[model samples]
Target: MFFATTALALLIERFIGYPDILVRTIGHPVQWIGAFIAWLDARLNPESEPGNRLAGMLALLALLVVTGGLALAVALALRKLPYGWVAEAIIATPFLAQKSLAGHVRAVADGLDRSLAEGRSAVSRIVGRDPEQLDRSGVARAALESLGENASDGIVAPAFWLALLGLPGIALYKAINTADSMIGHRSPRYLAFGWAAARLDDLVNLPCARLTGLLFALAAYFSSRTSAKAAFAAMRRDAHRHVSPNAGWPESALAGALGVKLGGPRAYGGRHVDLATMGDGKSELDANDIRDGLSLYGDALSLLAVIAVLLALAF
Candidate 1:
């Protein structure tokens, strides 16, 4: 039953995605979670507090209680309805984001064909870095990197949790993730207060990130444009190079698969961030590379669906 629910949600999200009208009408679940986090931050995360870390821990506990409880209530209520699994699947659909992620990444490639300024504008929407500082290669690399990282965060991780513990599982994961995105930074304001959110997000993402990397390697094995061996090897060799314990896995895999160097120095908010490079390949990235990355991403999703089906059949 869990497997069927996961597979159905994945397929539905892949084809139709979350509707824009629905998003505009009620906003996303993540946004709702973010609102709660914001409220907590304002009340509990003041910089002057001596016990900032303790406060952060308490805030995280509160968030978990609320999100997990709400999800459980929803799941239980849906079970009472006709075709309850279908209702559950519908509730789970917005959590996974395969089509939306691919579409946004593809838009960057499309924008690049028009002009460099347009390309920067498009990539800026998805990435956190300053777009004005990015050159043509930088913009393409940023888009591809976002694709790899979000493939884990937005798609694989959610599906993984949903398969394991149903609707409540995915809801819990997203709440942790949203907290990490909002407050889990190394900046002075967040360094202490956001510790629990950042660490917990990393812990949950660990397995899913590796799974996503392996799926990408499998996708490369079936593709003529990439080398599967190199992709896997690169992931093993360089996945730890990033500051993030999890993001490097998929990013390194995609870099080696596409024969492109990623993860060099980039700017975020007027500050230059010098990071380790992933692949020992060409650094000249362009629109075509972005298209190829998207294709590889699609192949990875297909492999994920097959795995979900197999798991369903087996368990």
Candidate 2:
């Protein structure tokens, strides 16, 4: 049932995506979670307090309890309805973002075709790096990297949790991820308070990140860009070089698969981060590279769908 639910949700999201009307009407689950996190942070994480770490933990715990309990109740209620698995799938559909991820990445490519300024603007919507600092190659790299990393975060992770624990599991994971995004950073303001959110997000993403990389490797094998062996080898060698414990997996895999080098020094906000580069391929990127990356993303998603179907059959 879990597998079927996951498969259906993925398919629906792939074809139609979340409708704008629905989003405008009820807002997103993540937005609601973010609002709650913001409220908690405002009340509990005062910078003047030295004990914000504990307060942050308490806030996170409260959030988990509220989100999990509400999700479980919704799941139970859905189970009482006719064709409840379909209902569960509908509820879960918005959580997966394969179509949207691919769309945004493709839009970056389209924007690059127009001009560098447009490219930077398009890529900025998906990445946090300072767009003004990025050149043509940098903009393309940013888009590809965002596509690879978000493939895991926005698509595979939710599917993984949903398969394991159904709707409530995915809900809990989304809540944790949202909190991490909202407050997980090295800044003095968030370093202690956001530690739990960041660590938990990393823990939950560990398996999914690797799995997403493997899927990309398979996609590379199927495509003409690069071989699966090269993708896997690059991932093993370069994945550790990334600042993120998990992000490096898919990013490196895609870099190797596309015969491009990624993850060199880049600026965030105003600070320069001298990070190790991934892949031994070309450093220069263009609009074509973005297209290739999107293709790889699509192929990897297809691979994941197959796995989901197999899991459904097996269990």
Candidate 3:
């Protein structure tokens, strides 16, 4: 199932690519599916209790199955509809955004080089951190950090799950990720309720995150700015140091791959958050550095697509 889905997805990605209208159309159905799932969740468990945890878990599992089936059904349904393979390909293409990912990262650097305010506004769309006080270097780092983390969340993780489990797998992963983003927080009210969602999201991301590092390293080897060997070594040494077991893998690899330091101190919600810096070289980052990071990141994704193609062929 994984092989077939990945093969078809990769082919669609290579040929038709992502179209804005296609992405927008996908959102309509995904929203309806998500709303139906949420309604069911609320009706099944209205209040929090020890037993509710078990019930919620069961409900989520059932939801995963149902949503997965629906995604597959929708894909098949699309195939039989008008406009032939071109339209179906467009529908599948938005699900993977390899080219757009690199373009957006480049825009951040462009905005920062022009003006800090411009940089902040452009980056704020991509990151949750406050952008107002960010200096030139801070803007670059934030953009790079977002690239690292989102490479997993927005691209690789979805591909990984979908490849393994088909539309159902991707839908299940997205649903869980959405739940975590919505309520899987550490706030007082959600401490207990969001625990499962958070843990499950982490588990889903673990392997894909590590694979992200490996891809970055491969990209570094092909690029002129950095050394892939050093990137791999640094990833092995520094990946576990971050608070998130999964995030550190890609961030550390990207830091070593680009020869720039990332993941330092920052402010959030009026609170100081100290973070472990990845890589030991190049404390200062500029627009050129951001470009280098994006290029290497692009290479990493290219490597991922190639591997996905190869895997699909092999299996």
* Top lDDT model: 1
Instruction: Estimate candidate 2's alpha-carbon lDDT, on a 0 to 1 scale.
Output: 0.91
Ranking by TM-score: 2, 1, 3
Worst 10 residues of 2 by lDDT: 46-55
* lDDT (Cα, tens digit) per residue for candidate 1, span 28-92: 88889999999899889765663378889999999999999999999999888878878888899
Tens-digit per-residue lDDT, 1-315, candidate 3: 465556566566645566668557655444655676567556654555322456556656766777777777876776576633344334444455556666777889899889888888888887777787578888899888888987887678878887776656667777777666654667654565556777898999999899888888888889677888878887988899998989999999999888789998887766678999988778878788888887787677667777777886888
- Against the hidden reference, what TM-scores do the models get? 0.97, 0.97, 0.84
Root-mean-square deviation of Cα positions for candidate 1 versus the true structure, in angstroms: 1.3
lDDT of each: 0.93, 0.91, 0.74
Expressed as tens digits, the lDDT of each residue in 4-112 for candidate 2 is 8898888889999999997889998888999999998888887677336787799899899999999999999998988887899889887889888988999999999
Comparing 1 and 2 by lDDT, which wins?
A: 1
- lDDT score, candidate 1, position 106: 93
For model 1, give the 10-residue run with minimal summed lDDT.
45-54
